[model samples]
Target: MAVSDQIVRWRYRLVPDHLLGEILTKRWVDNAIPVLILIVVAAVFGWLIPDFFSAAGISSLMRQWGEFTLIALALMIVMVAGGIDLSVGSTFALGNIVALTLITVAGWPVPAVIGATLACGALVGLVNGVLVGYLRLRAFLTTLVTLIIVRAIVDMMLLKYSVAIAAGFVDSDLWYYFGEGDVLGVPFSVATALVLALVAHLVLSRSRVGWHVLAVGGSRRSAHNVGIPVRRVICLTYVVSGTLAALSGVLFASRLGGAGADTGVGLEIAALTAAVLGGNSLGGGRGSAAKAIIGAIIVMIMVNGLVRIGVTRGGSSLLLGMVLLAAVAIDVRWLKNRHKFLSKVYVSPTYSELPEAPATSGSSPYALNDRLRPVEAIGLGQIDGPEDVILDEDDHIYVGNRTGDIVRFFAPDYTRQEVFVHVGGRPLGMAFAKDGALLVCIGGMGLYSIGRDRSIRKLTDETNRSWLSVIDDSRLRLADDLDIAPDGRVFFSEATVRYEMHEWPVDCLESRGNGRIICYDPNTGTTRTVIKNLLFPNGICMMHDGQSFLFAETWACRVSRYWFDGPKKGTVEVVIGDLPGYPDNINRASDGTYWLALVGVRTPSLDLALKMPGFRRRMARRIAPDEWLYPNINTGCVVRFDETGRIIETLWDFGGENHPMITSMREHKGHLYIGGILNNRVGRLKLDGMDPTWSGIDSYWRRT
Candidate 1:
């Protein structure tokens, strides 16, 4: 019975074996591929070479490999600071000469020699720092000069001192320990390198200095503007580089038992190779110390094993060069082409509303009045959440759904809806670009355009801001609505970074408004903030008079107008206030009236509850996903008001079995197409008798 139960458990564990296998495969591709290649090479070499994996062999390998690891670390630090130190090899030789001269000529103690050697390294670093940082020289050219100058100094010192094995020199106990001894099964030199590596990792990964390093690497001008002390960070990296190189020189002296002319020769190439192999880009700003260490290890293993297998030093160098070239090729190819791969893998469209309503030819769409009736309800279905609606001159309705899809419906008869674009973020608002493309506001993804061919691509994701950091998905969040000017400039709103779409109500309840309106110029292809610190700005509408425009302040329950031209250019004024409910989509009516949709009705009970701050705070702190604590969607209505902000009419749908939410309204060819965030079907209601002369103009009907 026990055996049977154990078998049952094992079977259960493997019940979802296919899913586990797929997950493991993806994980291997993401992380283990690089490590696996190194392992394979090591294994093949070890199998072919006699005792290559033995303890003695590893000791020899590690001690000799410490210098390469040190160099790689040095390069990594510089790379992180958005610079490079090509003079590390020469500085390393200088360190060895400094230590030897101190011990032999001055008869200094080992500790004093050590201090002098490190200080010498620091001096070299300081020189490099001054040239590149303070002097403002290009890193490549400045370091190149230092590399030659430092090497010349090293050669001059070597000749003057006649420092050879024959010179009266005693290798001290401390030197031997630093060079050859092991502590608790780890080599002392490797341990020292590891300690430095850990310190570098912490500084680069955790500290504020690290962020500055990344910032500088990403863009020097950007870093400078943000007051990151870019010059200091650049200077410090070279200093760290020189110090590390000097330490490597000391390790070299200990390993070889004497300082030689060629103590640090060819190290620059190896360090560069290792850094690139470990995945540090030559371009800088995108490297890690840990990766450099791994790269150094790979190079070390190859050299050591190749020597054991009787490969000449020259031949081994050739192979290392080939490996470095391959890594560079791979990096370049991925950087250039990976976006297409990622887009294809991630962007999936859920639904496309048909063009025009399904033609049920029983009656006229607006039989009640000559004016078409507005949409009574719109169902979100599995995915809809329409936030804005527009109608084209041809009576085609455009709907920007929060699900990130733009659907178009052809009109006269409300039928034939189809998905026009599959934008990969929550799409909020859209308008026709001057060149006839669809300019879309994709929340959390930035501004984008759907070309005539319907290809969705990013436009201006970030504005010209100094303090902003635009990492992958780090910058823009919750872009809500937009309107286009006659001059081809587009103004939009980024609602709040602290709260996303699902959490927007939380932001409203908190009343900590953090929203801004930005303008994007198609001619210049630039986006800038036009107005800052708005309270949940939602819809943006260009005025019919061509002077300025109005935008809905959702939380404040008001509409504000901003003047673009004439005497009051760049000024703002509130046109409407004290809305009865959350104001949503706004459009021009058939009879030159403006229609605004109020998705929910504000009751006195809800208003009093909203005033109690503790209620919302408690709900935010304790509410579960399944919990429901706000207004019921079942009792919502849509209202239309004229340009003077007076109520023209009300469209009421008492939430029940028929329709629940009425969020967006667009008038098309005498008919108003309605949309809701939560509903699953588009609703329609006919007006008995209204204006018949209305045509669906591009300005009046913008959603489609």
Candidate 2:
């Protein structure tokens, strides 16, 4: 190998250039900016305030953070439901006063005080729900009206009872314990908040109620069209919001021992700031419990930290207002242009070098002829995208269909067919196990099997994960082809971990070594990656000796041998390097030769583009996907080669008369069964001078 080619090879293999784009694609990347902002704010405050991260400081922050978190979560729920709760601050004051009066003055038990306070919140929520949900009143105006009415009522009551409330005190030990208690060094309010946050997260993310809330929030009209009960969902959201906000008030009252005029003033505004700043979407449909918690910490710390530093209340409020404006600005722009930014940066390309194309002339051994022109089409216009075909012991014709089924055409006539099994993923290459089980490669899923009873079993869905990989490569994304060795272990080709089966063309555009070979041993029920940094490894065929295997790297236009036993064990050697077309599945020919499927023919344009990584990168970012240049996969031929990697014969259908883009070919009973991923039917071509009685099943297992 040349110095430049070898350097490029190891550079990409050792250090994955694809990590940056992949990291950006992850769900948590949405919180990147907010997390950074939180870090910067905390650092600045920690520096300004002495012992800001000390035990006492953290304990103090937790008490206030926990209380504020519940209020933020409450507002987040309403905001997620496409509504706002301006009355939350007023309702909170009412709950605080109601709880305090009942406990200290009326001498009510703790449980009764809690119940009455919750009821007060529920009543307020009911009014909002009915007006906004059922009456179709504008949420902002309705909630603002509720805020004023509720605040006015609280003020009138406070004027009459403020002096008496401050003089009263609860003598109950449980009340004091809950108010100022710590469980295992963590404050009771913080512990309770954590528990409630967990429950809310599960409900919003995992339950039907949560899905309904998001659906309604996304679009009320669309949600109602889909029978999602938009009005009911809206009502449920407000009730949850009010109850949680009131619950926070109970905790606040417990700690403070009384309520005042400024008990919950400007709280709704603070909660709203926390919601959007925590990465929760203001447009609804996109929020999480974690986001609420994050927002709460930022808002609570900023306020408390300011007070601790002796910053005046007005100056602190102004700073908070500025922060809220910045948060809203981020929320608006980030939501609008996220995908646009991803489009430009996410389709990252890496440098790759390809060997010069060779030997496709008529005078060369790869000369194309019209052998497939007279090929008899089987199951014409019946099946869909049969990527690979195989014949069982009974000569039953099995072809993998794109509709997640293995369609089998009965033997002899090949007229009758049925869905042998529905695995519910795009099935590709297939092989029969020793126990008559049908092993299949399910694209985007993993390797699966169908036993004699037609029961489906998952062989493996994941391998040992690669360390430092941003994307989880352990989970199988595209299991393209497979073949069983002499041992119970199954070897398979993962075409590309970067792109899915449907996005196979994109993998070609990058043309990077994003593929690998995997081995699954049923004996120990263990799966692991055996080879890495391959260019779209597509085909696997266990050699006749069972000591090694033959695999194809599709984009590299090459075939390679992997030895699992003997002197060459644990090593790979290239068998053919200069094929003019992209090679796919390889199967044994009756006369001790191999049949290789050239799924696509190489063009000079694409071969040039492969070397010009910069050009391909810009093309991907600038051009529409359909307009982007792709290798010619529309037409290709089948090549027959000997054991020593020497070409024997070539089969062609120049105009694709019967089958185009041959992905796999199985030679059985002197006839070759041709399958194409883009073609609708399987083609059967008779061979003049081949073994008529030879069977694919008897080839490898019978010798053992």
lDDT of 1 at 433: 70
- Worst lDDT 10-window in candidate 1: 346-355
Model 2 pairs in collision: none
Superposed by TM-score, candidate 2 places the C-alpha of residue 512 at a distance from the truth, in angstroms, of 2.0
Q: Superposing every Cα of model 1 onto the true structure, what RMSD results?
A: 18.7
The ten-residue window of minimal lDDT in model 2 covers 8-17
All-Cα superposition RMSD per candidate: 18.7, 2.5
Top candidate (TM-score)? 2
- Where does candidate 2 stray beyond 4 Å? 1-17, 54-56, 206-208, 215-229
Looking at model 2, residue 328 earns an lDDT score of: 87
- TM-score to true structure, per model: 0.53, 0.94
Query: Residue 492 error for model 1, in Å?
Result: 26
Q: Residue 676, candidate 2: how far off, in angstroms?
A: 0.5
lDDT of 2 by residue, 1-704 (tens): 66875676576567665677888778787678778878988999999986888998888789888888888988889988888889899888888888888887788999999998888888888889989999999999999999999888888878877777899878887887666898998898898889999998999989999999988888888999999988888988888888887888888889887778888898988999999899888888888888888888888889988988999989988888898899889888878887887777767666666677776666888776787898898999999899999998888999988888899999989999999999899999899988889999999999999998899999999999999777789999999999999887999999988888889989988887789999999999999999998999998988888899999999999999999888889999999988989999999989988999999888889887776666787998899989988979877699989768898888888876667778999999899999999989999989989999887888867833
lDDT of 1 by residue, 1-704 (tens): 35744564345344432232223323223224457767888888878986987998888888867777898999888986778889999988988887777777777888888888999898999999999998999889998899999999998988887555337566578877877788898888888888888998898889999888888988899899989998899899888899999988887766665666776777887888788777776766777777787888888888788887899989988998888789878766755665544322221111111112211123422111212233444333534666666655565777766566888866655456788887868777767775667787887778898887988778788775625422122356778777777777788877764455677664465443456788888788877777765777877777887778887876656777888777898899877776656666566666666767665655555555444444554554455524624544454456666666666666665433454566666665445666666666565655445554464354433534
